[model samples]
Target chain A: MNDALPPSNQTQHSSDQDKPNTPITPNTRRILLVCRTAPYGNALARESLETALAAGAIGAKVAMLFLDEGVWQLAQHQKPQGIGRKNHSAMLGALPLYDIDTVLVDRDSLSKRCIDLAELGDFTQLIDSLQVKEVIADHDVILSF
Target chain B: MTLHTVNKSPYLSQCLADCLDRVSAGDSIVLIEDGVYGINCATSETLSALNKAIAQLMTLGVQFCALRPDIEARGLQTTSANCPFNLLSDGDFVDLVCEADKVLSWY
Candidate 1:
């Protein structure tokens, strides 16, 4: 409720007319997609993965972090057929093909859900909360779903 | 400053609280989608706590806003005197996004 705006000199605005079709620079942006929702119950998990894949496909340096209930997304032996939904766990295997191999999951989240690292397969790297913060700070863009 | 967009009802999810926790001074928060339910200002403990949070953050120069269309769709009443937040149009929302260095969406 501070009606006062930032100093006019400090305000930054990227007017649509400012740069038309800006070229992709050699320094690709580092994007970190964070997933905190369980799969099947909602579209968040699947959408987050799709976003990560899309960013990677567009040549952005993409990384993913699974936290909270999001760790369940990597659980093995998932059979979503009963719900008439395709099992999205298998799609995670295709991440490496998009050059997005740096997928991290919170260790505490997995333990709280009674999941083991082996169950998440070899693609995911189990990380602690402290390391998770480091990964967040390292990224140029952070998208949470 | 970051542009934080909350799209879930505060009563249903911790999205607003989580977004507030991560916001710093001068950051702006826009209640959109179901988040427009938060500005109801009805007689309730949750609304009081939310009002207090908004007032306190305002002291530190944090800006609070709500999407106009969502408010209208939900039939919520807001005015400069009664409401503590600004109501913005879709175009204004886009401008706010351009002004901020980063955007964070909470649902």
Candidate 2:
């Protein structure tokens, strides 16, 4: 039997909460991380979130775009307790603290999966195919996970 | 140009199709690991549909490639004359990765 507990907010000290946002210089790389996997049953989704936070921590301007099954990471009321996994959405809710404020979602992917935008919260910006194309062209670095 | 690597089979996953959908005109897609199955004669409905999508991307100048080592490991038969995409050795794959400004791996 496993007794491991999910990550807690205690790690984010109150002092750490007030840390100044990482400044982006003129030369800062605009990175786009396209996440296309679902949460749980695999580590890809968590890894994608970690990459976005890590990149943001290093002062790179980062944008996280969720497409296909990746949108599941943004699904509301996720209960991973039964599965013995951490709450994926809780980790995502911490993106802004790391300065990762840009989160895009493919409207088509959402529609196909029948997921309403309200369910994902207002943190995500809905983007169409044309917008997705433009976003891909705008980024200096694109990493798909 | 971006170097996109798809390491999953078209028959088993949606990685290749999704990658093709988002790729721009100048991007290159390298098929590695199980992705080599993409070029294995499209006799099924799924492969045919995926092949059509790939064909459309090819017309837009998206170069497709597969790793030779993985192909050999999977015992995939590919003669240059009949193969649709470039069969790359380990060194060539490294070169392709070096040439691209960024890389996106579809696992």
Candidate 3:
């Protein structure tokens, strides 16, 4: 295992770092990726995409959830040309191709944002935030971006 | 167990340091919500830098995982490589919290 020590905490030596969070055995490790922002505002959206892509590439059964403003990342009819930017919607359209096709958007966020169910591009699912909570409860890992 | 989570996007320039700060050598990080932003090629000099980072982090003994449903909805889950990436079910999330003594969020 690669070992990189923290600078300030170096002196507070603890064997905690050596402990394995996940064993090499079967079915023990998992992660949940949660996205709550649309692209173009900042790297949060891009980071969410890249991180999910990275996890999937690693052979992990990663789970991703979209909540709050995060649902905007999946909105339909995205045109970045007005902003002179590449369309994130286009990139999002390609996620299923990477084997990461469990996209979920919060139902409330959709209503709050006035996103029509029909507007969602192919490969996206719209579920209530309550369902999202259930989804998180079932995972071995939970992360928010 | 120690979980070294990274919460910033690669393009932001703060995530690298943030990861280095919160995550250690053996801990694992699950990409969540906007925290997934760190991997976009828009800011990556290398198209696979985000993937490379995940690989590199794992090599350091840290496990890296991401949420499946979110990416699936966002249409971004296909970006990752095929490794032992974890997709936690609701029960698993509870176990994660129970399993780890400390949980640090980058947000």
| The candidate that achieves the highest TM-score relative to the unseen native structure | 2
Residue-level lDDT of model 3, residues B1-107, one tens digit each, is 54444545556544544343334556666666555554343234553545565566667787666566544545664343554367655466566767774454655
Which runs in model 1 stand beyond 4 Å of their true positions?
A1-27, A42-44, A81-87, A93-97, A106-138, A142-144, B24-26, B40-44, B47-61, B78-84
Q: Of the pair 1 and 3, which is ahead by DockQ?
A: 1
Provide all candidates' interface root-mean-square deviations.
3.4, 1.5, 9.4
lDDT of 2 by residue, A1-145 (tens): 1224334544455446456773445337788999988999689899989888778878878999998899999998999999999999989988878888899999999999998778986677999987887788788888777
- Compared with the true structure, what per-residue lDDT tens digits does model 2 show for residues B1-107? 88889988888888887888888997898999999877663334656776677777778998988899998888887643644588899999999999998888888
lDDT of 1 by residue, A1-145 (tens): 3246565523444343256765545336677787878999899999988888888878888889887778888988999999998888899888998999999888977888898778887888888766765676566677988
> In CAPRI terms, where does candidate 2 land?
acceptable
**How far is each candidate from the true structure, as Cα RMSD in Å?**
12.2, 9.4, 21.1
In model 3 chain A, the worst 10-residue window by lDDT is A20-29
TM-score of each: 0.65, 0.82, 0.49
Query: Which docking band does candidate 3 fall into?
Result: incorrect
lDDT scores for all predictions? 0.79, 0.83, 0.64
